[model samples]
Target: MQTHAQIDGFDPERIERDVRRWLERAVIGFNLCPFAKAVYAKHQVRIVVSDASTERALLEQLGEEMALLRDTPADEIDTTLLVHPQVLGDFLDYNDFLDDADALLEALELDGVLQVASFHPHYQFAGTEPDDAENLTNRAPFPILHLLREDSVDRAVAAYPEPDAIIERNIATVRGLGVDGWNKLLGD
Candidate 1:
């Protein structure tokens, strides 16, 4: 659990309201796009991948569906070559992927490949420069794609009541949720 301040799409009351509002009208599907590259973090931009038919055999062998990418593309590397058709991983390991991201991008050399990382937006940051809007949206999770569809929200509830796995893993551990309804008090 964590205590987050009110921002754009996420509302304090509903928590995910801010995220849901922005994603409803997005055109491209993304899981999490951090504005920063392993240096600055200020917001959360998360989206989901809807297809697995474009990844190459190597990326698919990893069994990942969505990828957590930085909003700022590497000035030198061209990612189009890595986009392919294959299986993919759904989870995003923000910490692991963001660390030394530039050096790791070398794997993109393979053909027909895509990337997936933990659903974390540590790369997202709010800046003062007016000309930086383009950089901001690069990794922002605006339109989340659903492989299963919105109707399935309830199906997940029955299978993960009280958050058996996914929720427990996604959110932080020692967060200030004590001020935001600490689950420990309820013995959850």
Candidate 2:
């Protein structure tokens, strides 16, 4: 795999730092994903910075990351954040690439075992405007393909109270935060 420096002359360390900051400040700090803190605190979340500049190359790396996660134990690596800063930088392109990502999971016979969640710097939901507060729930420092285990998700949902309210609660939470608060929390 090519390093970010080799592909775009960007510092991988700084990219990772930014991702970690987003995870800590926005995701964990805001309680955006209740399941995230446990795995992250356990050091079971794998953060990979991909250097692919093309969709095909990024897909190849995604496949490899999926396979690795499949082979690895959940205790050792429960989830993976594949941050591809080079390719699919555009939100629409990144949104479209999710289909290909899922198809790759099916092709690899990992559809039932694992799933992909997406987070981009400018993630927007259907019918939501670009600057909508709800979008902040999915925003990150860069484009990240979050690979998760279905069993883990099921366990988390079963353990948590009112799992169905997560989305609604997140929307309300971000709306309460407002754009300025969100920016301040993320140190943007």
Candidate 3:
């Protein structure tokens, strides 16, 4: 099965360093986007994400837009399954729980197929960040993950072993918080 491991650029060398340092922890290889450009038009970081729904014509259109829009180039080689942050309602709670990467990863229901892993993050060094302001981290824990049923792991593995249903469920959840709809981007 083909999977994509999409990541944004903060610092390419640092990202590679962290990924290498934590290679033992990663569940799957990543298709890292080496030069991620901040989406100036939109608040979110623009990435070349792909899914089952993105095919043929739509894919072509997105390819064109990605060229026109600010974007990062594909970087990591030989990796599938997107590794990303799970959106949480509260940022403080999210920051507070990052202290225990091992505990957090241990909590995941990874078997042979399931995987949980991430690298240390590079911050902008703003005092308002509340944390160290300059620490490498995965920003691991959040109560939103607590909502997931452990049994969901099996279903997720059956679907997409790397990211699986778990990530999709979370994405649906955050999108639900907005009036616009994830369907516009992710598809129906």
Candidate 4:
């Protein structure tokens, strides 16, 4: 377990608060991710603050988090956010690290059990500009390694009326919010 004293530069409390704000205000408030509210309401979201300053350290931390998640029961903890503020500040670097993340999952033999979804302050889609409004859908106050259970995702997708439409709907939702609106919501 990482202690508060371990984190440097950014305050751990503030990171937790910001993550909650992003989850409650943006994700759940805007209904961007329809499944978020249920898990959040259930208090099953585990937010871990990591102090890794390098990609190698972050990967080690990620491995620890994955092991923790695997050891814990689903009823006790459904998901985890490996919130790292030190490394992968650049969106491109974070994006590239995801490949290694996948490889780690395979190495751990957890490829089908758990998967990572990414969120960053500057999340961008292919062929889209950095400032594109649609990217805000995945944007957060800091770069986040969202580890999710594959079973939960499958259940959510199976229950959703139009799971395939989720991306398009989220894109339209973000586009409708626009840059100015998003900035205001983000308190920029």
lDDT of 2 at 108: 99
Please provide, for model 2 over 57-174, each residue's C-alpha lDDT reduced to its tens digit, 9 standing for 90 to 100: 9999999999999999999999999999988989999989999999999999999999999999899999999999999999988899999999999999999999999999999999
Q: Please give, for residues 44-136, the per-residue lDDT of candidate 1 as tens digits.
A: 232332223433333342223213222223332211112111122221333332332323343533112333222222223344332322222
Taking the tens digit of each residue's C-alpha lDDT, what string does model 3 give over 76-166? 1111212223222244533443333224334432223222222222321235343431221222211111111123334534555455444
- TM-score order, best first, reads 2, 4, 1, 3
Q: Judging by TM-score against the true structure, name the best candidate.
A: 2
**Model 4 spans with C-alpha error above 4 angstroms:** 1-8
Q: How many clashing pairs in candidate 4?
A: 0
Q: Give the Cα-based TM-score of candidate 1 against the true structure.
A: 0.22
Number of backbone collisions per candidate: 31, 0, 10, 0
Candidate 4 — what's its lDDT?
0.89
- Listed in order, each prediction's TM-score against the native is 0.22, 0.95, 0.19, 0.93
Using lDDT as the yardstick, the better of models 1 and 3 is 3
Tell me which residue pairs clash in candidate 3.
3-80, 4-81, 29-79, 32-75, 32-76, 35-72, 120-136, 120-137, 121-136, 121-137
- Full candidate order by lDDT, most accurate first: 2, 4, 3, 1
Give the CA lDDT, 0 to 100, for residue 151 in model 4: 95
Clashes of 3: 10
Predict model 1's lDDT versus the native.
0.28
